[model samples]
Target chain A: MRLLTALGQDIRFQFRHGFYYAYLVLTILYILSLRLLPESLVYPALIIILFTDICALGFFFIGAIVLLERGQNLTQSLFVTPLRLHEYLLAKILSFLLLSIVSAFLIMLGGSVGGQDLLWFIFGAIFSALIYTLFGLVFAARARHVNDYFVKSLGIGLLISLPILAYLGLFDTPLFYIFPTRATLILLDTLGGDYALSEKLYSVANLLIWFTILSAWVYQRFDRYVRHPV
Target chain B: MIRVTKLHFAYGSNSKDTLNGLNFHIDSGEVFGFLGPSGAGKSTTQKILIGILNNYRGTVFVNGLDLQKLTSDFYESIGVAFETPNLYTKFTALENLDFFAQFYAGETRNPNELLEAVGLKDAANTRVSDFSKGMKVRLNFCRSLLNNPKLIFLDEPTAGLDPVNLRKMETLILAEKARGNTICITTHDMHVADTLCDRVAFIVDGEVSLIDSPRQLKLQHGERFVDVEYRDGDSLKTKSIPMDKLGSNDTFQDILKNHYMETIHSREASLEDVFVKTTGRSLQ
Candidate 1:
């Protein structure tokens, strides 16, 4: 219940800070691109847009919000509350993921992607959101300002997007499966009925394992951030 | 309600200690004040007690539990109001309060009532970004009391407030004391320390120089006399009479009986004066 309250507050804060509106605008843009672009280019555009915007955008989005909270010294108040770091992190991830989901769903819905693929798309979007949000926190903890935050986040963002190599045909080996973004790409590809069931299961399992590891890292990073905040 | 022993803290690996070997204890229901000049470790000490800074080498027992061992539950019983206003600027005053009030599973005060108490009733619906510094301070104070905490840590609680709001805040703090809540106030404002704190500790250079009740300190260091001002014809005359024998002193008696008295005031030292005398540093 407390988590829900915190989530509600976070969502409200995000909306008031223009994150919600930003997502709405992104959704409209995605819809327009799908409608205006050639059919053959639409799928690739959808993959790139969904992957980059939904999964990767959270790193910078959450970074911006964290920096704002730090500037206002709201984190000091939050640190003193009964709300633990995990609960706080969960609230942030869930809130930002809600925006990611909205954008992903609107794009996929407009693209006429449905059935099991849509469900996989939703799952992939959520996992990607969670991963990048946590990834953002690691850099946000060390960043002193928004400009520095974007710089650091951009570097980390590229590291997380290393899985894009598999999609671009630069690397096709199974070693790419280690990257969470690779899992997301595979999920999207499978959703489009281009991959076998066994491969889809492998991608889901790999993503889950990465999520578990990132979750632990995020928890510790958040703890350190709270204890000795920059 | 709070005890610290050999408290030592430094900001980084090679930095000097910000708080060095500090030791003090605050009794339950007591309004204890941590007084110091800027960079004197008053805020660092408060932050430790409030569980915001834990990288210190010390055993801090708040409400009978060691701070190092405390979980998030420790915050359920404590309230903290920072010197600067830390609030959601985009939210309305009431929304900010209500949102923070949800953090605790325990009972919380009504948001509207808390705002009204702080004289922010009219601005309940107004976004905090539009509030003045004084209004934001009051709203921050209101947020601290939301959980009805047993222990409250106020860092310069009355800073940026007008005289009227200062008085209101003092009343609210005293009321909290009356309700048996222990409060620890950190401030360089001598007037606030003298007015609200039952006992105050003077800190200098990350160490405690003196700790005593304000009244006791004043009486101990102040002159044991009363300054009597009276009108002699059209001119004013003043005499300092020893308080020990004022009732029997013939000169004092004669002056009281034969002179038109203007004012008689006890020669008591202000907290600021005692602070300077004790710590050799002003509370600037």
Candidate 2:
């Protein structure tokens, strides 16, 4: 009950501060850009826009929220409550996940993309956002300023985007799967065509593994950050 | 409600200890002041008690539970008003309190009632960003009371308040005490410590030098003498005599019997004076 209340207030805060409206504007622009693109370019644009704007942007959103909360000493107040670290992290992840899901929906709708692919798009967007949001929590954990936070966020986003080259058929190395981005892109790719059951399972299992590791690391780093934050 | 023994804490591996081998305890319904100058570890100790800073080498027990062992539910029983106001700037004063009130499993006081008690009833609908420093402090002080905590921690509770708000805060604190709540306040302001604390500890450089009631400390460090002023012709004359035998002292009796007395006062030290004398440093 307390967790739900906290999440509700956080959502209300984000809405009242125009963060949700900003998300709305960004999502509409991405969808409209896809509509303007040539028919042949729409497929590749879908790949880039879905991964970069919908998935990776969630990282920046979480980073921005963390920095703002730190400035207001909101984390210090929340730390003293009955709210556990995981519960807090879950609340943040869920809030951003909702935005990511909406962004995915709008992109797919605008492109006339549907069928089982929509389910895959929604699922892939959620897990992708979760992975990057955890990464964002680590990046912004010790940040002292908004500029510093974005600088680190940009750096981490670049590192995570390495697998995008392989996803685009520019890099042929199988080792690219080590990064969760490759698995996420493959999941989205499979959703658009008929693929072997084993391949889909491989992508799902790989992303889940990465999610577990990232969640554990995020929990530890976030605990340290709130206990003795910069 | 709080017991700390050999409480030693340092910020980092290479940093010096902020609180070194400190020990103190407060009984139920007691108002104890942790008095110290800036950077003297008063806030650090309060943070440790409130579970903000952990990983210290010490034994702390608050409300009969070990500090290290206590979980988040422990916070449900205590309230904290930080030295700097920490309310959400975008939210109205009442909204901030109502939002925070939802976190507690226990019943909480009405946000408007708490604001009214602090004389900020009119600012209930105002955003915290628009409030003055005094107004923010008043709101912060009352937010801590929304939970109706048994133990409260206040850091510089009246730091930036005007005299009127300051008195209102003091009265509210006294009211809390009257209701049998334990308060542990951290402040360097002697007047605040003198007025609200039943007992105070003078801390300097992460160590305590003295701990006693304000009246007892004042009397212990005060001079046992009285100064007598009288009118002599067109001039005013003053004399100091030992207070032990003032009634029998010939000079004092002669002056009182023959001359018109102007003023007579015993030299009692203020809390600030005693703090400086005991610590060899002023409370800045």
Candidate 3:
């Protein structure tokens, strides 16, 4: 009940500032521009932006929430209950993931084009958003301040995505199969069947494996790392 | 009922224990007080009991369950209010109560009724971040009772309030006792300890030096002399007579019978004096 109230407060805070709305409007404008480009590029660009936008927003918002809660001493009050660390982490993830998906879909709605298959887009978005939410929790657990989160989030995201980026940019190889985010991107692009059965299974399996590990790591480290000095 | 035996606890990698070989118990239906200074282990012990701190040595059993084991429904039966006023400052007083009120499985109580109990109904809608220290203290006090818990742990429960509010808090705590809850109060205010506690343990340097009722301890250590005052003709005089001889002494009886006796009473030691004597440290 308390977690729900806090999440409600977080939602209200999102609307209280003009900058929050501006950020959404700008993203919606970017999505509209993609619709005007070549038809061949629209699906791929939307797929990339879909996964990228959700992951970026997930990390950004979750990081800010964790750092701000610590600053406000809300973290201290939470532990006074029987609220296990895992429950607290789950509540935070769910609240942020719901907002991310809602806001992302809202932005995408302002534009006409989305993807080849709505089901594939929704699946890829939800799955990738969850993983990123867990990843952001792991990120925010260590970041003490918002600016530190900004610097460190870019560094960490780059560090994790580098293996695939380097393969794509420097070597020009098909090593997009290595990073989980790119795997999700490929899955989104292959929606409505332009790919083989085995390829689809492998793509989903790859994402599931990485998602499982990241989720476990989030649960294990979140409470164990951050706690009142009881 | 609560029982602790050979309880030893230490901070991370510290050479000495915060609490070293401490032992105590409280029977059912009694208000237990733990009095200690800032660095003493009062809060540490309460944390261990409330299942906040693990890695403890020895055993603690609260209401017959092992302290280390975390259970789903135990929260419904217990409540804790920390000394630091750990409240969500961004939420209003009503919202703060509403949030924490969800963890318990018991019947929910109205936040307005609870605020009224703590003298905070008018400020229910005001943001806690805007509240004064005393207002937060009242909110913290009210938060501890939201679940209508059977066992409540309060650290400095009456901190940062005016005298009238302090008295109201005292009455509120005793009222909880009337409802058959076992309360553990931790504070250095001997007056609070003396007034509210049925049995108080004077803890110092991580160990309980003495535990007893305030009246009993005062009787045990008080001076056995009564100050007797009387009016002799136009002059008033006072004298201290040994209480043991008051029954047989001729002059003591004559003063009480013949002259206008003003006042006569025995001196009783206060809880503060007992704390100072037993621990050799001032409660202040």
Best by lDDT: 1
Q: Kindly list the interface RMSD, in angstroms, of each predicted candidate in the order they appear.
A: 1.5, 1.7, 3.2
Candidate 3's residue-wise lDDT over A98-155, tens digit each?
7667766765675555555666556666777777777778878778788888787777
How do the residues B86-135 of candidate 3 rate in per-residue lDDT, one tens digit apiece?
Answer: 67666689988887887665776787998998889899999888998889
lDDT of 2 by residue, A1-230 (tens): 87787778778877888878987888788788888989888887887887887877668777778888887888887777667777788888888787777777887788776666556555677788889888888877788887888897788789878888877778767787677887788777765656677866777888899899989888888878775552
- Consecutive 10-residue window with the lowest summed lDDT within model 2 chain A: A114-123
* Model 1 pairs in collision: none
Clash totals for all models, in order? 0, 0, 1
Q: What are the per-residue Cα lDDT tens digits for candidate 2 across B87-145?
A: 88989999999888888889998888898888889989999999999999888887788
> Model 3 misses residue B40 by how many Å?
0.7
Model 1: how far residue B113 lies from native, Å: 1.3
> What DockQ does each prediction reach against the true complex?
0.70, 0.63, 0.40
Worst 10 residues of 1 chain A by lDDT: A221-230
The lDDT, on a scale of 0 to 1, for candidate 1 is 0.86
C-alpha RMSD (angstroms) for model 2: 1.8
Superposition error at B123 for model 3 (Å): 1.2
| TM-score (2 decimals) of chain A in model 1 | 0.91
Model 3 regions more than 4 Å off: A1-49, A71-73, A80-84, A147-153, A163-178, A191-197, A227-230, B227-239, B245-265
Q: lDDT of each model, Cα atoms only?
A: 0.86, 0.85, 0.77
